[model samples]
Target: MSTQVPPIHSTAAAPMLELRGVHTHIGAYHILHGVDLTVPRGQLTMLLGRNGAGKTTTLRTIMGLWQASQGRVLLGGEDITRLPTPAIARQSVAYVPENMGIFADLSVKENLLLAARQARHAGQMDEERLQWIFGLFPAVQKFWNHPAGKLSGGQKQMVAVARAIVEPRDLLIIDEPSKGLAPAIIHKMIAAFEQLKAAGVTILLVEQNLAFAKRLGDSVAVMDNGRVVHAGRMADLAADTDLQQSLLGLAL
Candidate 1:
């Protein structure tokens, strides 16, 4: 049998985000067990794992939503594990949770405006960036004054991502942007993500969709039992059906 070690990429490049020996606990039950992963600068890294594998827990820990009982979370070589959520956000990290996190009562414009921390009002927002976001997700522009709850599922997903990138961010972390979307919408999302990557936005995504992961991921990490069981280039994993089946429990 051939030995398989977690593959590392772009060693010359410093990681925009790193987790070292991270552990998380919720009440008496332990969730994460010493997870170590790295997300390279200007690259899209995908986090994959089956249900109950602590994928979401890892992201929550990074966001400071759930305090890590142990370990270090680093961004640009700075330790941010202990920082508060607002402090983490101030560092230019945008997290879009699986639930989409949109205010049902707010207008689409209001949602994007709220995400621009420096802008107190719609007019104060950076017009160029807003235009770019509109170009990326046109639903946001088409439904500017419409209540968010009135939009369709795919439109709401677009709005959620639009809100995240309403301003320049050092890192964009999203959980399952393709979840519950039609094939056409997922294709559009893949294109949007490609554009974001081309523009040099670092992305960390937790996705159950293998096609989505294979399409946008520059680097990939697969978690199992609350630990990273495999890490490598997305292309490497995509080309190896056997490895995919072993790590993800099914071939892509």
Candidate 2:
């Protein structure tokens, strides 16, 4: 059976992740400009924006891949703005980039084994949890010994996600899980996220697909010009076409 964490019921609960006036610069180019964002505990928050809007930069800053030049990144109410990527990961935050980082040379099983820090081998990994993940993405178990590089795009995305959850994670950050996926595969991806939400894992996603976002998002933040321009309930955003057009330039 899945282990259930207490669900977050109110805005009063401490946010699982918070970015306060965060600014980031890469060399001479200033990317993020005083972004203020709050990801409520135990909810899935969608980060939406157009190209060059700095959505990826926000996620990268949260992961510490890019250092925030100003303000702070807080996790469970603690400052982590300056922490290195590995140190930040040790705090139980898992990030999957747009590329879906995985060791292509390794078998699917080996890829998951690496993510499970407590497990030196497949046998040492949590069998119950592995079985649960297998149920979520059957391709993981079906091609256990196949090289990750050999799998199709959709299968590889499943493995990438499965690896992130191989060990329990307090926060899961993903960039565009449905990008380039077929409609059928997108539906399966949606189902997997639904299950994750029910399990109370706090998730932050950057997606261009408004339909997918509307279906899975509990809260929504829209970024423009390196700042969060809009924030509100997903249901509210879904209901207001004029607001959607004004913020996102399109209706959901």
Residue-level lDDT of model 2, residues 1-252, one tens digit each, is: 976534333234679999889999999999999999999988999999989999999999999999999888888877888899999999998999999998999999999999999999899999999999999999999999999999999999999999999999989999999999889988988998898888989999999999999999999999999999999999999999999999889999
TM-score of each: 0.94, 0.94
What is residue 79's positional error in candidate 2, in angstroms? 0.0
> Largest lDDT belongs to which candidate?
2
Query: lDDT of model 1 at residue 236?
Result: 98
Cα-lDDT of candidate 1: 0.92
Off-target runs (Cα >4 Å) in candidate 1 are 1-13
- In angstroms, give how far residue 154 of model 1 lies from its true place: 1.0
